[model samples]
Target: MKNSLKLVLAVVLCVFLAGVAGFADEYILGIGFTIFMYIALAQSWVVLSGLTGYISLGHVVFFGSGAYVFILIWGLVPVWLGVFCSGIVVGLVSLIVGYPVLRVRGPYFVILSFGLAELVKNLVLINEARMYVSMRPVFGAPALYQLYTAMLLLAIIATGLTYWIRRSRFGAGLRSIREDEEAAETIGVPVAKLKLLAFAISGVIPAMVGAIFIMRSGIFQSGDAFTPIVSFTMVTMAIIGGSDDAPGPFLGVVFLVLLQELLWVNWPEVYMIILGILLLGFVLFIPNGIYGWLSEKYFGNKKNVT
Candidate 1:
């Protein structure tokens, strides 16, 4: 009951924000769109990494692939259909890659994932150069509004899925794998399958977000599409928000997006340094993240006592 109420309230708040953005100036709507994009990415990261405790440094592989695919195919179909197809393509790719990569564990898995993104980026660069591929510009307020709505819906779906998973048997299996894969396997959890499923689920939304991003920006380049910074940003948001809880990534997105808009805009030169300082502070003082800390301080102790 309480969980449902929280979800309802969250959805209402998101809708209210969207309504405000619809009437506000273009700048405000742009900011809202960016926030929604980050939220979608962060929630997607939380789906696999947070629940399964598998840190992927190359998740942007899916994102870039989706963007490139959308750019290649959008002219042949409706933009929305193109974005959906891009997600499907990424999901299939995840399944193909997950089988082999998911077999590895620990730093090996992280390194392999990171390496995959770099490999993909290079391949994209080479392919684009060889084919002379370029995306045509997109314009108009209607397109921007479409991008905004797509992002908002994607963010809601990603977070809602995370919440559902957190309370389901599948979520429990993932949690078990996170705690100890060997033990989970011994206890009859299908660790491999669960991980792959989680990976596929996690990949799809980010890919869709990538498609929306490229559509809105009206351009795509391998360097920009496969930027390692995006991977880091998503991971940081999930970690800083509370990887163990569904609401953590949302909180992280809100806090960091606001911080970026307010402070990074003013001191763009030292933005990364500022972000590093904030991350370090969180790691040192509140390692479990803001949500985790709040949960522990307020609800955890009370539950224990009762």
Candidate 2:
């Protein structure tokens, strides 16, 4: 019964998103794109950090890397194909590194993730300088509505994957890892394989997101592609929305994106300040997030979906 309602609401949302651009202006489409992109990012984060408690601080690495790949191969392939290639490349790279990366647990894992991201960012910056390329400009971009639709579709796919995984045996194994890794492995949970798979899966969409995202700016700089702010926003949204479940990202993204749209144009730095404050408050107080709070209030228990 609950799942049925969720399906109905999802359908309604898809309909609204699909139809919005027909009448809405560019600003509205931009907002929709931003919200949907964040939804994809946040949900992807949930697939890894939320379930396994790895708490990645460098999620943007995949996003930026994917965009760089896309732009590097730009004009050599169809736009849609480039988007796909971006995701595939990022996923493959994650698989290559996931073994060593996932082995580190707790705060060490957090620091390593952040350190790796910074490392990648600097490498890209230096490479760009060596190539004598300051920024890559995107030419012959798709219409705003088309990119918006693509992001919306990605968001839905990400949410569906998260929802399905959360209810599967795999999700149980993942949660077991979060609860007690050694015990889970002792009980034959296949902890290592599952973590690597989840890490790779979480990486794909964000890369595709970055591929589409660079189109919005019509240019890509190493700095913008690898910006720490993208990583911060993903963690912030997940923390606010409750990374445990599929719906948490939707609630969190909508709330913050709307607030962002209101304050961003007037005082951009102010938005960053507010984001920092909200992060601290949410972490200190409502640690379980909006979804957890609401679930405990109405549905009965604050079930940990992650």
| Candidate 2 per-residue C-alpha lDDT over 121-211 given as tens digits, one digit per residue, 9 for 90 to 100 | 8999999999999999999999999999999999999999998899899988998999999999999999999999999999999999999
| Residue-level lDDT tens digits of model 1 in 1-306 | 396797798879888876775667778778888888888888888778888888899989889999988878867887789899999999998899899989888888889989999999999898888887743454431457667878888888888888788888898899888889999999999999999999999999999999899877777888889999999999899889987766889899889999998786698988888999999999899988988887789776421121
Against the unseen true structure, what C-alpha lDDT does each candidate score? Answer: 0.85, 0.92
- Candidate 2 vs. true structure, TM-score: 0.96
The C-alpha stretches of model 1 lying farther than 4 A from their native spots are 134-142, 301-306
Best by TM-score: 2
